[model samples]
Target: MNSASDAVKEIVIEIVNSTPFWTAFSACFIAYLNRNKGKKLTAEKDGVKFSLENMNHHEMTEALEDAKKIMVSDNGKKPT
Candidate 1:
């Protein structure tokens, strides 16, 4: 069990070591988006619920940038 744990750790180490920053970032972002789905920016405004699907492409892109900015600022760390 200890050796298995060590092996797993080694594999993780290799993966993290070999992965480029952008690739890791993209993977994490995709996973986050997948997990979030309908939860992303869903809000009740007035009597209407707003979501990313309601936004235009430019607005959606800006919203994503805003979300990334908030995340990085709050955590003091870049995604992935």
Candidate 2:
């Protein structure tokens, strides 16, 4: 019984230590992360969608400027 259990344990450890298993696991994990990292719109108006992940530097700066303008116009009042 002890020998059989040891054999099973070794087999499980071998499978876990194999390169193919690690490679497959890494590929799946990367795919999962990439899938989740995709562009997600935070706001939309007049058919224009805003997504930080998809924006280039210029677009981000423009959005930041627009937000600053809105904030300034609001003068500490939260929009309802």
Q: Tell me model 2's lDDT, rounded to 2 decimals.
A: 0.46
Model 2, runs deviating above 4 Å: 1-3, 38-80
Cα shift from native, residue 41, model 1 (Å): 16
Residue pairs in collision within model 2: none
Once fitted onto the true fold, the runs of candidate 1 whose alpha carbons sit more than 4 angstroms away are 20-22, 26-80
Candidate-wise lDDT, in order: 0.45, 0.46
How displaced is residue 25 in candidate 2, in Å? 1.0
lDDT of 1 at 75: 25
Model 2 lDDT tens row, 1-80? 46988999999878765655545544543443346554232433244554444545445444443221211111232322
Estimated TM-score for each candidate: 0.30, 0.39
User: Which number leads on lDDT?
Assistant: 2
Report the Cα RMSD per candidate. 13.0, 18.3
lDDT of 1 by residue, 1-73 (tens): 5798899999876664443533544455445545655434343334444454345544444344322222221
Best by TM-score: 2
